[model samples]
Target: MLSTLAMSVPADSNWINFDVPALIQNFWSATFDGLTFGAIYALVALGYTLVYGVLNLINFAHSEVFIVGCYGVFFTLSFLGFGPSVPNLDFWSIVLNLVLALVVAMVASALTAFVVERVAYKPLRKRNAPRLVFLITAIGVSFSIQYLIFLWRGPNPEVALTMFRPTPIFDVFGTIIDSQQLVIVLAAVVMMVFTDQFISRSRTGRGIRAVAQDPDTATLMGVNKERIIITTFIIGGLLAGAAALFYVMRIPSGVQYSGGFVLGVKAFAAAVLGGIGNVRGALLGGLLLGLIGNYGQILLGSSQWTDVVAFVVLVLVLLVRPEGILGTSLGRSKA
Candidate 1:
């Protein structure tokens, strides 16, 4: 074409070129960031997946539950006056603070879950309401939780500049893998392991499994459906709360409503991708989604369309496998 158009072309007519090296560098950066973000999403996704596994209902309010946990950490740290000042202490003291904050958040979120289950879901389940009814109730609970946070914080963002900061273990190349990421990853992993063990080994966990498999039969067999559902919510809530702590650490300043809505939506997508009612699927789905979103940005040098990419992937996956990566037609089953 160049030769053919030489008569019309001036000195040069060539193909467009871009900075390949820069693109490669950005891709790697995006990949790393995606992995970290994916880890966080996985933690949040666990809540959705776990509850869905047992109850067959998505806890829409789990997002706000996580935000509440974030607020719990923020307020606790605020009262301790640990902002912007590195408390000169031994490694053990720092570890203590971290553990305490994480525990508090987890406990608070678990309680929130319990309360929500009792007030919003249990009654309906007892009456044998349709799943759509539960869906509406979940949405109401989610918005109510957000409003309650707004009432407490009055639409202000929590910004702990230096306080409750995670100790950075080291740097990979130039990217800083701070203590916060480690905290989120470790806490989430521990909770996930505990949950897996509980469901697989413990008595109550067995009851929950029995309920999921066949609620009527399980009830006939002496399994208390209410107790199992409440337990599932508590576990899911605890994980969300822990995820909130690490999430806020990364984005220290954000509106209260932001976490529940945006992150919640993403985590739900992860849950569906991994197989909504499968715990392991949720983890894998969240990680995969996060990685794809982050790396896509690096490749394109923009995140303006990240949501589009996410939805597109969702659509493609659904088209290919409507039941998700690990989904089945056996109805609701234990993960």
Candidate 2:
């Protein structure tokens, strides 16, 4: 898209607007907004990290997994009697609705992840397909899932009714941190922390790491590779689903069949920026990417430049540190 824009736009002075003043003025707002988006990115990145750490595959279809979760969220909210307008529910009722939405989304996405694994990936694994074959299959699966949703829901985006009205939670410097942002950020942090602990401290986590480090040896030692792979995909799905819920909360009108592409790209970039297989790296990369993209949009005075800026920054980082911000792979980490 950036390339197409650059090619189509005239070589006039107005094409690339540079607005340092706007950037300076909106610094705090952008920072807070970036963190909200970064939180979403980090959750999605966790999905990418787990799959890549174990299978050494990008799992591009994970984006579709997220969108599936979005559908689940939409249905759950609709079933709860929430409409396009804000509901007049008491606080506890509202909380219950949100909790239900989150759970349904997670389960939906996780189930999709499991099915995709069994239907699309397991055969390739059994056949001992090459890395390129797996990559192609992943892309194919992504498209298949996307178009399937397209056929089911059509091309138009569904605007899920407002589940909660955003009220001011607190003030950070000059920025008024709202309830929606607070919830999304807090939820993402809690999920990431739990995932980190699970990966680091649990027996299943050790099995995952053992497989990632040396699959054959791990398998020989009684670690079930199939079960671990399934677990990894499910974990990724859970995170992606949570990200989907937060995304819908932030942008109630953003749900659609193809909506996951841009988000998946950003999440994948976050994973790569933070060190693809590292736990902490995804979080750090996501936050930084969000800040950079948001800042670029302000500075350039065009939202179109956001992704271009993020990718440019990613390239620069890779040039400086090829292994990403946190250079440790999950399999090899001692702590």
Candidate 3:
């Protein structure tokens, strides 16, 4: 069976290109692409970081929440009568469609996060369950949500309808920077800044921080732990939903049921790389990871090795700094 399976798998010929000069020549373009992808990873990582900061539990099913956002984009675009065959929209139409799709995706993802919290995590929390139980429950919820989507949407990848075809907005050192790339980076940065400010300055943000610091003390101080938890989940979901929209814009063919698995793992790695509970760490780690993976792929000569390269980077980083680049010591608030 192993022999047969090996024979059935096709070989990747483009796995090793050792053209250093060519790699150097395309460095700018690669960096642009990396930053764009890194921003998406950062957004997803924020979800992981935020939830972990508060609950100290890794919500493995957060990926499913992201997948829901992707589907939300798809259904919204379809409802708007946009598809592969449709012509690109006019300027105002593009803006309207994007706004609508973003709203829908955020709402869908937020709802999914709330439901997951209520159904999966809340019960365990109330019971004062062991950490192992929470981990197992998280894995179970992740699988259940993934397969449920598979049952509903089937195993096929959904193609996102392009509302606006990418047009080159500028050139950087002979590399053309397109509209989609600009949008992704700008949107991610804006969202990150907003989130950081909200957490650091807003009333609700203070509640979240207090809970992360000490749930018992926070409760005593009149912070509604349940409400704060729900808020954190909702904020994370909102970011994940926006990231999903950007992701499909970058890789339109990435809307399958299992799509979240690898991306989710990478995002988690990014969270850990940046200091899992640190908000800014997620952003920094994501961008760095993106650049590393892109450069590694170029150096290795094939996109097939991207995942391997990313994991290797993660392992190396962990070995050097187990707390992550900006991660604080355990039990300390870093967000």
Candidate 4:
């Protein structure tokens, strides 16, 4: 009976589509674009890494931090006479516009992160709340921000004026590298490097490492625990804000009430993929996840199934290396 049932099954099943030929054909373009999106993921992942490093909290609300920064970019551009139509501004003017927008996004995200810490997480810390309680609060704060944005913006996406048409920057093999991809990838790398430097080289960073290694002992060493935690969140927010700017630049129509949900999940996965507790690991994870996800989408034959492919790859990686590719290393020694 079992043999008969197996023999009756269709040889050509459409349920799980795997278009390997298509993936191979579009491999170059997909890899390039995947890197673009992956940069955004890595930027957001830093927030998760930082908070988890210091407080041992996941900070699910960090996604909202990113979306809030996107909104900041939208409003800043709108104020500078940018709309849905093509801009008549000169090239230098466009540069200025983006620079201003970046500042606003950074400030907005940083402040939001600071407030989340003060209002949402600090009280819990004062009470010496359980880790589970901190996790729940992070989720709650995330929802609260999401709904507030929903109430204010409704459900539609906010499309912005095109920042500038992406020009060809250079070519890599057969791939045409565009301005947008260049900016996103380059900016993300620069920021990540700067963050790594700060964490490893600066005095304040030393204090942060101390806290991550042993919070009680760090406090005893005359390091201000609250200040270090606040600084960590600020840095995370700054990176998230930068990610938002690049995100809106790459996909202008992505700005919405809950735009950060899926991106946030991907970033978190990237963090875990690189090693949840490690800064450098998050960066590696983000880039690899991006490439893998792009290849997966092409192979699977649809953008909708991208997440399915991404998570499957993540599971595979976990099975092979539970500590992640780079393992969990913050600025300090391995936890």
Over 4 Å off in model 1, which ranges?
Answer: 1-23, 84-90, 163-178, 328-335
Tell me the TM-score of each prediction against the true structure: 0.86, 0.95, 0.93, 0.94
Give per-residue CA lDDT, model 4, range 1-335, as digits (tens): 44334434436765565666677778889999999989999999999998998888999999999999999999999889887776888999999999999999999999999999999999999999999999999999999999999999999998765888899988877789899999999999999999988888789988889898899998999999999999999999999999999999988898998899989999999999998878898898999899889998777666777888889999999999998888775745442
Q: On residues 1-335, what C-alpha lDDT tens digit does candidate 3 reach at each position?
A: 44334434447863344546546877999899999999999999999999998999898988999989998988888889888764556789878988998999999999999999999999999999999998899889989999999999899998657767889999999999999999999999999989988888789988988888889999999999999999999999999999989987788778889988888888999999999888888899899889888887776656776788888999999999999999742235434
lDDT by candidate, in order shown:
0.75, 0.91, 0.87, 0.90
Ranking by TM-score: 2, 4, 3, 1
Which candidate do you rate higher for TM-score, 2 or 3? 2
For residues 169-207, write the lDDT of model 2, one tens digit per residue. 888777899988888889899989899989999999999
Tell me which of candidates 2 and 4 scores higher on lDDT. Answer: 2
Whole-model lDDT, candidate 4? 0.90
Q: How far in Å is the alpha carbon of 45 misplaced in model 4?
A: 0.2
For each candidate, how many residue pairs have backbone atoms clashing (under 3 Å)? 0, 0, 1, 0
Worst 10 residues of 4 by lDDT: 1-10
Number of clashes found in candidate 2: 0
Runs in model 4 with CA error above 4 Å? 1-12, 331-335
The runs of at least 3 residues in candidate 2 whose Cα sits more than 4 Å from the true structure, single-residue gaps closed, are: 1-11
Best of the two (1, 3) by lDDT: 3
In order of lDDT, best first, we have: 2, 4, 3, 1
